[model samples]
Target: MAASPTPSVSRAPLGTVPPTWLGKRPLPETSDGFGVRKPTPPELRVRRFTLPDTVAMLPGTGFASAVVTPAPARVIARSTWRPGCPVKATDLSWIRLTFRGFDGARHTGELLVNRTVVDDMVSAFHDLWDQRFPIEEMRVTRRDELDAPPTGDGNNTSAFVCRPTVGSSTFSQHAYGLAVDVNEFQNPYTKGDLLLPELAGSYLDRSWVRPGMLTPAAIGAFAKVGWEWGGNWHSLQDRHHFSRDNR
Candidate 1:
């Protein structure tokens, strides 16, 4: 039999809850059987603020392509980078690439990564583009976004956020531009009772399979370049995360 055509996906604005999740009861536990708990008061406070999605979805110009250049200081000023960040701005590279979107159209996206891994990142993403893997959005994350309210529905594909590992003071690989998170809403961070995009519980049911969700092919694309997928971690499942050191 012929394969079914891919379903077209509508791009919902950030913070918009899918109808499927509305009125659904909070997940009682994680797939590992660990009981889910409520977010703390501070976490609840952060969720009160909402930010609009402002990424410009430009049409892809041609074939899948990647351009890596020095990360401009001016652009770095707007990102999470600071004077004391782990990596120097001069050691970072700004990458512009084309990706297939869930809309089944081509789109342009950008990322900031360590210069040392520029080739690895480019090669992996180029393979993903060739595989027609869809990404919902990709853009540089701003420093101010660190404190922004949790929309619990963001799906931005990003790298190089100057933040520490969750629940720890040590710097995360992303702080050094050595890690990336792709389609985070489709592949959320889950540990015990905590989920980064809190409303992303539905995605834990990976059996449903949806566009933009990482597949074994996608994992292999990054793995071929020596990056490790967080989904393989036994202590926690960070389905959207990939890093050079498997942190």
Candidate 2:
């Protein structure tokens, strides 16, 4: 009998077979899409179809944790105050504070308030920040822009406005930069059939609380500074308002 033909063997280049066909190898440590480094030599010895006691291995499982730095000191600039207003700039200050925005991100806001309340404003806002209360916007109201309609107009977290109280010629507390209206769209000024934003009917029910609405904690925060809430008004309810009046 002829000698058995030598067994034949076939070989292919390293590039021939798909990677999946090869034996499993350690995944190379790489940067996550967000630039965070993925785990190397993973903390857990997870196997196929088996979950670890802790899920720390899951991608993005942990939060970066919000870091609210020390609230910065108040900053003053020309644009921070309205030009030639009834209230002198010297009596009013531009306060810069860190606020949590409606989107849950950190933001810097400016409030033009009477100098007497700057310290109180800082302490109050710091408490608000620690509580993560949301603020829509905060800026100094320009004297020229005060002529715009107060009701149904777009403004939020404004302090100073040279305008009279509704239906009264007497200047409003805002005219003296002693009041602040926060998250107006979420906590509107209302009286009878009228609403400041006009579109804030949803917030009419004080029972239903939402982000940016004044929680008891927020009210307490301002109260600590001797600020009164407009929600306590007799006729109209200005849930978003806070002022240090009759102090």
Screening candidate 2 with a backbone cut-off below 3 angstroms (N, C-alpha, C), the clashing residue pairs are: none
Candidate topping TM-score = 1
- Clash pairs of candidate 1? none
Candidate 2: C-alpha lDDT: 0.59
lDDT of 2 by residue, 54-104 (tens): 111212322112112221233334233445456665676656666666556
Reference-based lDDT, each prediction: 0.76, 0.59
Give me candidate 2's TM-score against the actual structure. 0.63
Candidate 1 lDDT over residue span 1-247, tens digit each: 9999999999754323234442234445556332343442322221212122344544446545454567887779888999899999988998877777765566777799999998898899889988988776778999977865454656689999999887679999999999999888778898777887776676677897866789999999999999999999999998999999999
Candidate 2: regions farther than 4 A off: 1-86, 149-155
Worst 10 residues of 1 by lDDT: 43-52
